[model samples]
Target chain A: MLNELKNLISKEILLEWRQKYSFGGILLYVVSTVFVCFLSFKKIVDVPTWNALFWIIILFASVSAVAKSFIQESRGRLLYYYTIASPQSIILSKIIYNSFLVCFLSVLSLGVYSVMIGNPVQNLSMFFLTIILGSLGLSSVLTLVSAIASKAANNLTLMSVLSFPVIIPLLIILIKLSKNSIDGIGWSVNYRYFISLFSLDMIVIILAFLLFPYLWRD
Target chain B: MKHWWKFVAVLFVLYAIIAGFLMDVPALPILHETIRNLYFHVTMWMAMMVLMTISLIYSIRHLSGFKNEHDIVASEAANTGLLFGFMGLVTGMIWARFTWGTWWVADPKLNGAAITILIYLAYVVLRNSIDEEQKRAKVSAVYNIFSYIMLLVFLLVLPRMTDSLHPGNGGNPAFSTYDLDNNMRMVFYPAVIGWTLLGVWMMTLKIRIKKIKLKKGL
Candidate 1:
């Protein structure tokens, strides 16, 4: 199972590599969106507003990058996976792949956002920790959601409709957490948020693992 | 005989409605009379939660057995849950308007409630977007489980980490925290059971209607 998961994760990475346009497209997406934010706000003077805008950009970027990638996995590809892999392996690999994918994309987005908009984040390490947690939570839920949506009409709108509500809660916490980081608040004020965020991620990952087998079957 | 709970539900609900208005003693400032809403407004949320939990349980059963009957029941329960959620939202808004002087506020619990509504609305939309029978059932059940857990994270886990305007959340006086006394509990507990049973009754009725339609080739 470990080997199968490793191979599946590598297969995803290889596919993303071979189709560099998709990878480059997500990068361009991040840069362009940050540019748009920069254009509108000129320069956000308020730290909380800046924090909120940054996470919002990351949210949209992840939605576009991760979910679209899952949607494009193709019926034939899923069928091929269905033949060779256990459902647990498939979902685990997809989640692992998307987590790293979105994690990288969001980090890049953060860089672009801070460059264009001015970085006010006071605690760099704590903020990075939140980003890592944020991406994992976002990708795990979106991967399961896209898998469910893919089995349906394949309507792209359905993906947004399904994912946004589920994602909003995570976003609220992430914004609060990062806001704390931007304010340079000490970690004592943050352990609760950290615990909640970590537990939330665990809950989502566990749900995806347990429920994917049912979804993968005919 | 087996349907005794329906009679009990009706009896309790009728009593709650009548007494909820006529028998309130607390006279707190701002929320003096409106405290009576605890029986009506808050119970809607309780019922919604109970109904959604039932829906989640049935979704798991559907996934395990691949039974169309269980899927139908799951959807119906979720439908009823959504109805209760709407009731809760409107009542909450009304309650908020009178007390908070606004139709909405940026609070964690309110945001959580809004997210809960959206998750189930997405669930309903997901069910509609799929065309195949077995595929829809299987796919929706997986989604039902996944979204429910995420919603739980928002509703249960995240809110505890933040200060909120809602009672039982922060230090705000809870409709007379000192006097959530037996007087209130007498009505509140039965009201909760009454509304939840009423939601279940509605769900079961819809399930039977669906089964009949299926039998009739509709």
Candidate 2:
């Protein structure tokens, strides 16, 4: 099972890299969003608000990037071929690959955003930890939801609609933890948010793992 | 055709009206006139949950096999769910305006409910855009299941996190205590049951209509 999972993950990652346009489009979207935020809040962007904007951009970028993962799989019976391997393997691979992509984009965007908004992080390590944990929850949920929504008629809109509600709890926790971390609050002050976020990610990933088999069946 | 159910539904609608009007009398200082909307809003939310649950069941059935009835059931239930969701949204907005002095606030409960409704609306739009019946059914079934799970997360899970002026928040206690007294319970419980039955009846009728159209190749 581990070998199969590894193989599927490598395949997807290679496919992603080969599709340069997809990666470029998502990166450009993130950059342009940060640029717009800079222009719009040139004079009044505070650390908290900038923190909020940073996550929102990352959230939307993750959605856009992950929504097409399954659609691409369905392009020409690729989903069928993958199922011949193992549905669990396929889903796990997709989740892992997408998590990597989302975390990278989130960090990159946060760097650009901090430069643009000029808000120095009081605790850079803690902020990065929060982002990493939050991105795991975000990417896991988005990958599961996109798999479900990819087969929908309006994949893009349906993905957004379906994912937003599932991710709201995660978002609430992320925003709280990120805000506290940015404000230099100790982990003790924001520990509940971290635990909640971690638990949510685990619950969702387990549920998705159990449910993806049903979705993969012909 | 047995029409007794319709008669019973009509009687319940009349009862709802009477309960709503009585709820408006000035004797209740705590709730006052705004309590009238509670009959509709709370009942609509209950109905939405019932319909969404039905949709989830049908999606499960659909995913298990290509049974046409399951697809029909899923779509009909989703339609009814959307109807109740809209009613819940409008009623909640009006209640917010009167009680909170705003048309809408980012109150976790209210915002979560609104976002859930939007997600389901996107489900319907997705079904409409697809031209192939089998593909549409399969895709929609998947999307419906995803959205329903998210709806549960939003409506059930997220509210526990933050403080809100809404009932059932901040350790202030939930409405099930004094807010739902015997008098309100008499009306409220029946309203919930009646609306759910009505939604199911509507969905059955819609399924029959769709079957007829399919027979005619429409």
Candidate 3:
């Protein structure tokens, strides 16, 4: 079962790479969004606000990618083929793939954002920890929502509608943590946000694992 | 045609209006005039939950292939649910503008309710987009079940992690603590029951109308 799942995940990753547009489009969207934010905020966007903006941009970019994760499979019996393997495996593979994608995109955005905004990173370790925790929460959530939304007809709009509310708590925590990190607030002061975010990630991922097989079944 | 149901509904509306005027009758201090909006906002949320619950129950039945009535019940309940959801949003917005001195804040309670409504909205959109009736019913039933779980996670579970000005947050007692005294309970409990019954009543009428239309090939 593990081997089959690994193969399935690898296949999905390779397929995504072959398509190219999915990754390229998401990267382009992230870069353009950052540019737009820079244009609008200009010099007025402070460090903390810029940090919040960075997370928001990453959040939307992650959402865009995950929302389209299953679109390519919608055309054929690709979903059926996967169901023949195992629905749980399929969900796991998608979650893993999307999580990797979101993490990568988040890092890329963070790098570009730092350069563009010229905001000083006070604590590299804490900032990286925040990104890791925050992206995990986001990827788990987007994976679950995308699994459900992909089965819907209007996948994009439905993804937004279903995901936005569910993700607000995580978004709030991420924004706070990012802001605190940018402001050089000690982790002791903002540890609650990290705990909340990690707990949310665990709870949501477990729920998704339990619930996703049902969705995959006819 | 039972006259009592409509009469009761109208009476409740009238009582709500009367209560609105008497909201500042010097007896109630904590809630004050904002309590007037409570009659509408809380009632709308109760109605929305009732309708969504009905939708969920019927979705389960539909998925299990109990009967076609389940689909009609789900659809009608969703329609009624949306009505209450919209009212909840509007009323809550008004309440916030008055109480919080702003039209909106990302308060957990308000945001959770908004997200719940959006999930249902997506459900309706999902149903409308699919042309095949059976497929639509089955897929939506699955989505409905998933959404209810998400709703619980969003509204009940997530709020505990953060500070919210809304009731039931950060050591602050929920409305049930002091706000829902016996005097308020008299009207509040009845309001919940009455609004729920009316929601179901509207749903039943809608389902019957749909059945009739189908029978007449309209």
Write down the lDDT of every candidate, Cα atoms only.
0.86, 0.78, 0.75
Clashing pairs in model 3, backbone N/Cα/C closer than 3 A: none
Considering summed lDDT, which 10 consecutive residues are worst modelled in model 1 chain B? B173-182
Model 3 chain B scores worst on lDDT over the 10 consecutive residues at B23-32
Where does candidate 1 chain A have its weakest 10-residue lDDT segment?
A66-75
Residue pairs with clashing backbones, model 2: none
| Model 3 agreement with the true structure over B1-218: per-residue lDDT tens digits | 77678667767766665654564422444555676566678888988888888888888787677477798888889998899889889988887787678888978888887788777777777788777766677667767776776677677766776688875687653565645465565566566666777777788789899999989988
> Cα miss at A130, model 2 (Å)?
2.3
- Sorted by DockQ (best first), the order is 1, 2, 3
Cα distance off (Å), candidate 3, residue A78: 0.7
Per-residue accuracy of model 1 over A43-151 as CA lDDT, tens digit each: 9999878887777777777778777655787778877887899999888898888889888987897788778888888899999999999889999988888888878
> What's candidate 2's i-RMS value?
2.8
Error of 1 at B106 (Å): 1.1
**Per-residue C-alpha lDDT of model 2 across residues B117-212, encoded as one tens digit per residue:** 777777777788777778777867866776676667767767777788787787543465635466776776677777777877888888899899
* DockQ (Cα-based) for each candidate: 0.80, 0.42, 0.40
User: Which regions of candidate 1 fall more than 4 Å away from where they truly are?
Assistant: B175-180
| Candidate 3 residue-wise lDDT at A129 | 86
